[model samples]
Target chain A: MKQFQYVRPTEAGLAINALLKDSGAKFVAGGTNLLDLMKRGIEAPERLVDINRLPLKEITKNDQGFNIGALTLNSSLAEHKDIRKDLPLLSQALLAGASAQLRNMATVGGNLLQRTRCPYFYDTSMPCNKRLPGSGCGALKGFNRMHAIFGASEHCIAVNPSDMNVALSALDAIVQLSGPKGKRNIPIQDFHRLPGDRPELDSVIGKNELITGISIPTSALKHVHYLKIRDRSSYAFALVSVAAALDLEGTTIRWASLAMGGVAHKPWRLTEVETFLAGQQISAGLFQEAGTLAMRGAKAYEHNEFKLKLAPLSIGHALSIASGLVKA
Target chain B: MAKEKTSKASRRNFLKQSTLITVAAMAPPVALKAAEEQWDERLASAIENVPLNIEVNGSVHQAKIDPRVTLLDFLREHLQLTGTKKGCDYGQCGACTVHVDGQRINSCLSLAVMNDGRKVTTIEGLADGAELHPMQAAFIKHDGLQCGYCTPGQIMSAVACIREGHADSDEEIREFMSGNICRCGAYPNIVAAIREVKGGSKV
Candidate 1:
């Protein structure tokens, strides 16, 4: 790893200002992903403003719902009684990610900002537009088993590798940010950006801005499920995961929210499917239609053409389990 | 604290001088080597090292080091605690697992300077003087290792798994202890060891 200056700031403004002062500076919360990228020479920051000392590690409940600090470790949030009881889907997705040790070190905000697991991005020898803008996308013509199926452009085809983001999208969580200009809140669906011409920009977060916390509104959707299909049963990234939450009234669905992972540049929210499932009775035929609607415009590459079939099945499976119609 | 820092600084200086002298004595008669050393020293002096005071295995160590030095390297290279093995170093493998503030984390991914005032417990700290920890003894009794390369990480993770109450069953232990990968395929025995420790007593 390249040598760099390290600064631990106790105040959020100071950390933000330090990053603003140097264009090559970055904020290190958990260092789970940043350090790995640094060691591999994929990323080289001149200064690292350590934000671990900042006062941002809190998980509080309000009338609006829950406000989780950005520095809240993934393990703590997953095991919290309130989270497990109220938002089991989020807890399940968190547990399905990485492993015990990684969950201990990874922060909620860091998880939101984790880079794609595209092999082309990691291999500096290859040309990856996401890693180096205008360098060209190697995944488009090379091996791209894990490339995006939606919201992908000609510049890049990498998919976002985050289970937590998928669950957040289904839960309608809001991300709170603090910057030099003050504070703002962005809905979870808009937090991650699609890979367009500027593939280097992963999100709408501006320079000198820091994610302070996340706000999730109270929900009456008690039935929730996170189904992840991976290469292994444990400690592996998802091949195609589904986050499904439904509010059921007798045998009919009152409301529904669905999201997918390992298929797009961001969490693929199924608004059409959610609309189609609402006010409808739960049945195998209905779920099959919802699955078909969920994969309407999904385009798959050569190596990942199996996802075209696998994604719809995962959506149906997740909804069946979430609606209590079938056992997970 | 002041006296301890002073003494450590002096000892560091002595070691630096001795290493330099030994290297010079062993080198061949090459004038270009001396010029290269001067250039290296000039470049080294340009980079500032960050000061860190980390407590590991109940010992407080104060030193100035490169900011890129990870907690795993600091423990194994500087403190000579070789039990914490480095596997894959990218946080994919858990061979460098250690307890930071009573929580199991991958030390390889955590920078040493980030652990300024935190307590770190490595495999060396698990024993009570000469006696082995129950988890350690369990691994030995069950023959839970073949190459023994990932043993320290497995033991550390296993202790944490039981403490976190994730070792209630064989399936639960396997899922929670998935972080530590034993390339030699000692998982069944590793699970048995963890089950014995979990069934026997508190971790």
Candidate 2:
């Protein structure tokens, strides 16, 4: 690992100020991702602002919903009573990700802010737009199997690899952030951005911003499912995954939100599919049609043509599971 | 969760006197403690060498280390407690799995400073003198290891699995133990060992 300076502030305000004011520092919450990147030489922060000492480790009950402090470990979130009871999908997604040991230490904030796992992005030898602007994305034509198909820009095609964020997207979660100025809330759906012009700016979060908490509002989605299709059942990134939550009256769908992972710059929200599935009877054919609509605008490269097929099937299966038409 | 956090004063009692070695040990006896202390006083103040007063099993230790150092590294390197392995430095792997404050966590992922004044039960601390932890004993009895690199991680994760009520059934054990990967393909024996231990009592 590259040698660097480290700071551990005792208070949350001091930590945020240190993070925002320091031009050469990056916040180290759980250090699961940051430390890994640092060791791999992917992220070289001249000064590591260790925010672990900050009081960002609380899991509390708020009037709006469960106000999970940013530094709250993933295990705490998964096992939280309110989350398990109300937002089981989030819990399930968290459980499906990484391992028990990681979940216990990986914080909710770091999980959301974790970088993409694209082969090119990870391998320093390869060219990746996400890693270096104007360097070109090697995944576009080389080993593009895992690259994004929808809402992708020519600059980058690396897919968002967060299963928790996928569920959070379907649940319409909100992020609370503190910075040099003050604090602001950003909706989960709007938190991440497409690699439109600058693939570097993965999220709307400013460099100075430190995630404080995440609020997940209550919703009447009768069913929720996080369907991950990967090579292995354990510790594997998704080949194509879908998180769908639905509200059903009798057999017809009243409300729905679908987010596709391993196939987009962000956890993709299928508004077109949601609009099509509304007021429609829940059926395999209808779900298939909605899935088709969801992946309609997908653009496949030389290697990721399978996603054109896998994306729709996965989404359809997730919608079926979320609508109570299939088993988990 | 209030019950989860033990008070600092209560935790201090857990550390043994032996761990409280004098700060005199930090310097050469010949060199004056005041010597060169003025040169980097600012740098030293920037990073305080926090004392980790923790109890591992029945024994307590006070580790004076860089607060940024992780508990996993502190145990493996400074303390020379290597029973807990470091597989994927990232929390993704359970190689450095251990019970901190009575809960399982990826030691490599947590800063040692964060665990100050907490009870830490590592694999080395799990056994009673010469006796192995039930999970460790069961692994040996069932031949649940091959290369043996991942055994420590698997065993630690298994203990947490049973404790968390995730080892209720064969399928549950398989799903729950998915967190700990055994590339040696001794999963069947590992499952059998965990089942044997859990079925014994207090499952």
Candidate 3:
């Protein structure tokens, strides 16, 4: 790792100012991904502004909904009583990611800004547009079993490797950011961007901005499920994961929110399937239809054709589990 | 325009004379060679070190540390607490697991400067002076280790797993302890040890 200066700022304003003054400065909160990237020489920041001292580790509730501070550890958030009771999907998703040790060190903001687990991006020798702009994407033709199947441009095919983001997308979370200008709230769906021509930019956050907290409206959806399918039962990135939450009225689906991970540059929201499931009776045939509708525009690469089949099956399985038709 | 031109010419002349004077001052060949040989090392050591006041294993330590030094290295190298191992050096492996503020975390991913004024408990701190911790005793009783390379991390993570209430069942223990990889296939024994400890068996 390259030697760098470290600053611990107690105030959010000071952290923002430090980042604004130094273009090469990065905010280090729970340096799980950043340090790993630094060790690999994929990220070499000249300065790291430590935001752990900032007053942003609260998990509070207000009129809007539950407010989770950006610095809250993933382990704490997953085990929090209110979170487990109110938003079990988020807890399930958080526990399904990385491992017990990583969840303890990872922060909410860090998880939101984590880089892809693409092998090409990690290898400095390989050409990855996400790692270096204008560099050809090696995953497009190389071993791409984990590449994106949705919202992928020719320049990059890497998927966002965050399970928490998928649950946040389904729950309609709001990201609170503090920047040079002021505070702003960005909806979670718009927070992460697709890899168009600009594969380098991960989030819509500005260079000098720091994430303060995230808010999720108290969900009325009683049945929620996060199903992550990976090579191992744990300690691995998802091959295809589904976050399904449904509002049901007896045997009928009142509303639904669905998102797929490991298949898109961002969490792939199944809006069409969501719409199709609304006001419909819950049945095996209806779930099959919804799953087929969810895979309408999914395109697969050479090694990831299994995802095309696995994605729908996982979605169906998740829906089945959420609807209480099948036990998880 | 005329004043600017004269000023630019004088600045150039001053720069040339200063370069000549600097070279003349370094005319001693031996002195220049000595300075050149030690310049890189000197400058590297001169890089600012952050003041860290960390409490490790119930002992307070005050030291100046390089901001890039990880908590794992700070424990193993600086403090001579080699009981904590560094398997992958990345967060992928749990060999560098340690307790920060009573919560288990990957020390390899944590910077020494980040944990200033915080308490860290490594594998070295697990046992009492002459008595082994319950987890350690259980590991020995169950023969949980083969090569013993990943024992420190596994023990730390297992202690945390039980404390975090994720050791209620065999599957939960396995899932929660998935971060620590024992390549020697001591998993079944490790799980048995964890279960025995979780069951509150006296060693």
Most DockQ-accurate candidate: 3
Q: Clashing pairs in model 3?
A: none
The 10-residue segment with the lowest total lDDT in model 3 chain A: A17-26
How close to the true structure is residue A326 of candidate 3, measured as C-alpha lDDT? 87
Can you tell me the CAPRI class of model 1? acceptable
Per-residue lDDT over A229-305 for candidate 2, one digit per residue giving the tens place of the 0 to 100 score: 88887778888988888988999889888888888878888888888888989999998898788877789999889
Docking class of 2: acceptable
Off by over 4 Å in 3: B1-37
Model 2: per-residue Cα lDDT at residue A227? 90
Candidate 1 chain A: minimum summed lDDT over ten consecutive residues — where? A1-10
Error at A223, model 3, angstroms = 0.6
**lDDT digits (tens) for residues B1-203 of candidate 2:** 13212332223323322222333455664235434453234344344456678777667888666655778898898778999998878766677888987788888877777676778888887788897788888999899999998888888889999998888898889888886777779999999999999998532
Evaluation by DockQ, superior candidate among 2 and 3: 3
User: Which candidate model has the greater DockQ, 1 or 3?
Assistant: 3
Q: Estimate each model's TM-score.
A: 0.92, 0.87, 0.94
Point out the worst 10-residue segment of candidate 3 chain B by lDDT. B1-10
